[model samples]
Target: MRSCWRSAVATRSSSISRPRPIGDARWRRAELGAQPDLTAYRLFHGDAEGAPGLAIDRYAEVVVVHADSAAVLERWLPEIREDLRDFASAYVKVHPRRASRLTGQDMQQAAPAAPLWGLGVHDVEAIEGGVRYLVRPDAGLSVGLFLDMRDVRAWLRGNARGLSVLNLFAYTCSFGVSASLGGARRVLNLDLSRAYLEWGKHNYRLNRLTLDERDFVYGDAFDWLGRFARRGERFDLVIVDPPSFSSSPFSVTRDYPRLAEAAARVVAPTGILLAATNHAGTSDERFEAWLQNGLTRAGRHGQLAQRWHEPSADFPLAPGRTHPYLKVRALVLD
Candidate 1:
């Protein structure tokens, strides 16, 4: 994988004209196809794979092409669709540079409701490490599961046996599902959106796991963490994976330390805390500092157990970058 990254960097420096052709992406796809159980993965990482601002992901029989702008989508979509002809459907999603200024409706309008090529099927099941996840290709910005978090989910599935897991900011409860499947004694998912919690239930059902209504909690993560701390309820494993930026107090840059402190209160002594963020601007050193500050303020001593990054096969780091946009750290609290 390091060779892949270096080669990509070399290719970038060597060429100044047309971007790499779809054949390169096709080669990567063929390599990924060897894994029978996994059906969802990034086929092309635009930032590192010669196609800037353009990425392609495959979910089961569906292929999704993400372009940073309308022009990028228009430029690469046809060739990508042709290159991935084995897929049943193909869809395009445009991400404008000034998307932050656009309203929700405006963003939705940027993506087509129907497939740009092939069948009209939108809803599909994506399998990763033999776990089934419901994915809708035509659904607005995200398709239920975050492909970059695939390795994290797989790690949880292997390590959660007999542990009581608490998943904070559990969008669609993917972590909860993975933990439950790994034979965790109990798993509680807390999120701000009731609708997303319900969607999480659907994910649980897709895996044929029994769903307990009490396990799905809908509320602000900070508020719930406070309540859990007050009630003296602790978990053996706590997962904190929040969005990079949200309204007001949920901003990662400004509030992650507070969130980490609150989350630490509910982690049992000797338990593991897995904190993750996808903010590209925040370097790893600063993120670890934030975690240390929060743990020190909480009066808990801990050691860094492990660090996880995005799968390099699908998410190669850009030239000279030491880490990807996604950063995950595991701390063992004493």
Candidate 2:
């Protein structure tokens, strides 16, 4: 597959034709499409914040497009439609400006809900954490799935069966879903938002799993971890995927190291701990230091297992930009 993708890209490049050859964007698209699998996976390359607010996703035989840019809707739609004619079936998902006016206390709070006009229908099967879920993309800031964590999820699912799992900073409980699918006997999800916990329960329901069996604790994850330590509760597997910053009385930078310390106390002797961060500005070494120091301060000893990367080939960070999104590193105490 790698060679095929390389060849597909190289076929368009020529050293003999001119002194300097211009790279074609179509070749990039072809490379993206010629990956391991392209079913139910599509690509869209338009500015989300700029003039062109165009999005395209393939669902079954249909290709859904959302044209929020006026110029693209008026001028480029015909060309885009013609180019996409060979791609199964195509349809437009409109995101009119007036239909998406969000008003709240602040700009961040005023932003419209995530589903912003691209196929408002619910229950799309998005793969994450080795589980296929009927998720609603428009539900919240999260699309019910974090496709970016695909690789990390796969690794955990394969290794976590029969383990007592703890998922902190659990967003719609995708990791818990994957852990459950991976045959975990006991799973605990901790989050501050009860609404999101409810959504996580819905996601579990979508997979025909019982949430009552697994513990869903609604409280500050840091506080819960401290309580877990006091109670001498231990887990075999722990996944920490927290947001960059939250108003939930817990700031990541201020709270992450403390969280790591708490994690070390609750982790079993032979357990595996995953401390994942999406802060792209922090280097890999710094992230490792933070975790290692926290564990040491908490009087826990663990060996570094592995540093996981994004499963997809498309790297999200530009080299020049400071991206703190480091991969999830697994630490083994055994």
Candidate 3:
């Protein structure tokens, strides 16, 4: 009997459990109705929401269950499916683990997440701060949108009026969309991928925002920054948010301090600059220090206006955590 009890305990320990909800859902339900307006938000965030290796995000009536380990997702897929029966569609993706080559393979070969139930679809609409953006489930790597940047978009919506905004390293141009929606005079989105820029244009159309050919720039942001500086081009607001690593010739990899210097050059004399990164291992203080150093390199002094935090209550960080995996600093150039 002791052996049997031990076996049962081991099994329980191996199995994945449901994650806790983020605070009260009453406000979310009231704003979005019974089903969370995934266009805005719904579901769990890993570590933050009590599910360490798993996260479930809702896009309107569709659900996207993202897991750190595919095995954990596979083990609990059935329970997840049944629980999300009311959702119009459901999808899943395995986040690539970069611990080692073998771990990377494990993530790549991890059980494919198909539509467990409901009409399995790839594309969906999600809202951030009242602005609509398109999200594609199971897309290579990113799955379309970075949900954590929700507050950055919110900040832009509130402050982009009559200003010219430059979004450097703009993935799908989410910041540009926010600036446009917030009545920016001109918003330029610069990225390395033409495909992503085209998709960004689709997002503009989805939100009924007008688009000009020049608004979507498909080139290296770093190269363009130099040219913009030489041409005396300046923007009231400049955002520099680069991926942790990139092989692209023009992209900055792990060297965000250098990227920040390039970013500050184009900020208008009395403009705002937002530099952010999601690089793991770098503490919050270190990241902020890098941005500060970058400003100094550009011969510009920056006053910290506000360090942007996640606006969505759903993204909870560990209690009293200072460097919570993501860092965004908003500074005003002097």
- Candidate 1 vs candidate 2: which has greater lDDT? 1
Q: In model 3, which runs have C-alpha deviations exceeding 4 angstroms? A: 1-38, 99-113, 249-253, 319-322
| Ranked candidates, highest TM-score first | 1, 3, 2
lDDT of 1 by residue, 1-334 (tens): 2233344344444444644555465465555655778888887888887777888887887878888888887777666754566567888788765554568789677777788878787678888989999888887766788888888898889999999999998989999999999999999999888878888999999999989999998888888898999999999999999988554366788889998899899999999999999998889899998899899889887788878888888888877676678889989999
Number of the candidate with higher TM-score, 1 or 2: 1
Candidate 2, 76-117: lDDT as tens digits: 565455444444334444444433343333223322333323
Q: What is the lDDT of residue 259 in candidate 2?
A: 76
**Clash count, one per candidate:** 0, 7, 1
TM-scores for every candidate against the unseen true structure = 0.90, 0.71, 0.83
lDDT string for model 3 (192-268, tens) is 88888988998899889999989888887778999999999999999888877665543333477778898899999
lDDT of each: 0.82, 0.62, 0.71
- Please name the candidate that would achieve the greatest TM-score relative to the true structure: 1
Which residue window of length 10 is worst by lDDT in model 3?
20-29
The segments of candidate 1 whose C-alpha lies over 4 angstroms from its true place after superposition are 1-20, 97-101
RMSD of each: 5.0, 6.9, 7.6
